[model samples]
Target: MSQGYAIELYFDPALENQVLKAWNVLARRQISTQLIEIEARPHITLLSSPSLEPLKLEGVVRAFAARQEPVPLSFFAVGSFPVDNNVLFLAPKANMALLQLHSQLCDAMRKEGVDVGEEFRPESWTPYCTVAQDVPKTRMAEGFCVLRDLKLPVTGYGVDIGLVEFPPVREVFSYVLGNPVEG
Candidate 1:
């Protein structure tokens, strides 16, 4: 089986923490069943590639970092893919700069022999944060209702991109590219 790697765009420090807090509250209230579990960090995927040659990985990160520009993104509604058994958060508003960055990164990855799935096509893309997974239909509805009732804040800011890897059958491994910036 092929290993998975995701190049993702994330919110800045403050916003990331806030989103986490909100998600934790929602999870505690609505997610008590065994059929669903919310895992994975909050992020908007730029590309999901099966594999990258070791040498090419650094180049990919550098290419993405060089083009980095901060942009604001907002989360407004909660939604779900009932058939797929997943719950997603919706960002009712998006920044063009952020979308452009995703596009450019896709183009760059294609040039590097990465086969990004068609699902990521620009026109079909819907920017969202994944809040829960393996959600049954009943829980999905309940979760959506919970999010709908809450006045979720719209968090926004510029954030650095990250590369996450899953080696073989093990769980995901993540690396934050570039030097750490002082707060």
Candidate 2:
């Protein structure tokens, strides 16, 4: 069977910690069958496609790294996809550079014959940091109660990107594509 791969924009560890902290608080108050533990690195998915050869992946990452410059992003309010009632997320304040990067990445992936979901396409997208998934309605309400009262911190410059692999039946492995940001 073919493996699954996801090209995602990972948050620096500091920002990830904050998101985890919030998620932990919500998990404690919820009773849901969904996976509540925060395992994968916090990220805003750029694209997820079928597994590609290592060389192809390297080329894709290199191309993205070369064309895309780092940009600043801020986290704002908390929101939910009411229909799914399965995700609780932190919103990102509007940033044109981020949007443009998203668009460019999608375009690049398409040129390579990758099918990025129409629902996740640029124009209709709302950038967010997902905190929890598969949350039960009651728990979701409780999570909202807590998230609504809290103030989430924004990562001033979250420009790092990463490539992650999720095998058909194994743990996910992630690799950072660039150097760690200098303090």
Candidate 3:
């Protein structure tokens, strides 16, 4: 019964729909991954912490959201970690704006005493939208085919910061990014 929150970037509705379609196709092909809950939405995780109170976590996200605006992110490639061939993902190209936001949020969370772990820190994080997880090694080639043909241009803005509970991974609340200059 472990619980935690993740700060994630969500895609536009149209792009989201397409990504869902791909996930369905892969599942139908018998290459489903873990964490395939139907309620889970497509997102890129920016930060996660296993030890923060929900109400306080909400405040942290609110303060972090105030300093950001919708950020344009390009999904330019597909990549997988060799250490864990079980997962496949869409990689977002490097953008200074996105990186800075991640850094700022991580810093803010740390300042507030959230023990954001090492992997999620800006320096060690790899920005990606996971398409599948827990893939069987025997199905690796089949998964690769799905990824190869899954290529499509995806460009959109991450317009809101959402706090998602893990395990079941449900959205608790969302804060639309607003201009910091107005704050």
- Top lDDT prediction, candidate number: 3
Candidate 3 weakest lDDT stretch, 10 residues: 32-41
- Summed backbone clashes in each candidate are 0, 0, 0
Model 1: clashing residue pairs?
none
Clash pairs for candidate 2 = none
How well is each residue in 158-177 modelled by candidate 2, as lDDT tens digits?
Answer: 65666666643222433443
lDDT of 3 by residue, 15-125 (tens): 677668768877888797454564778888998777657787777687778878888888877778887657888888879988988888888888888877889888898
Provide TM-scores for the models. Answer: 0.78, 0.78, 0.88
Against the true structure, candidate 2 has what lDDT? 0.67
Give the winner by TM-score.
Answer: 3
- The regions of model 3 sitting more than 4 angstroms off are 33-35, 83-85, 179-183
Candidate 1 residues 68-115, lDDT tens each?
Answer: 656677776666664565655656466687678778777877788777
Ranking by lDDT: 3, 2, 1
> Judged by lDDT against the true structure, how good is candidate 1?
0.63
RMSD of 3: 2.5
Q: Candidates' lDDT values, in order?
A: 0.63, 0.67, 0.79
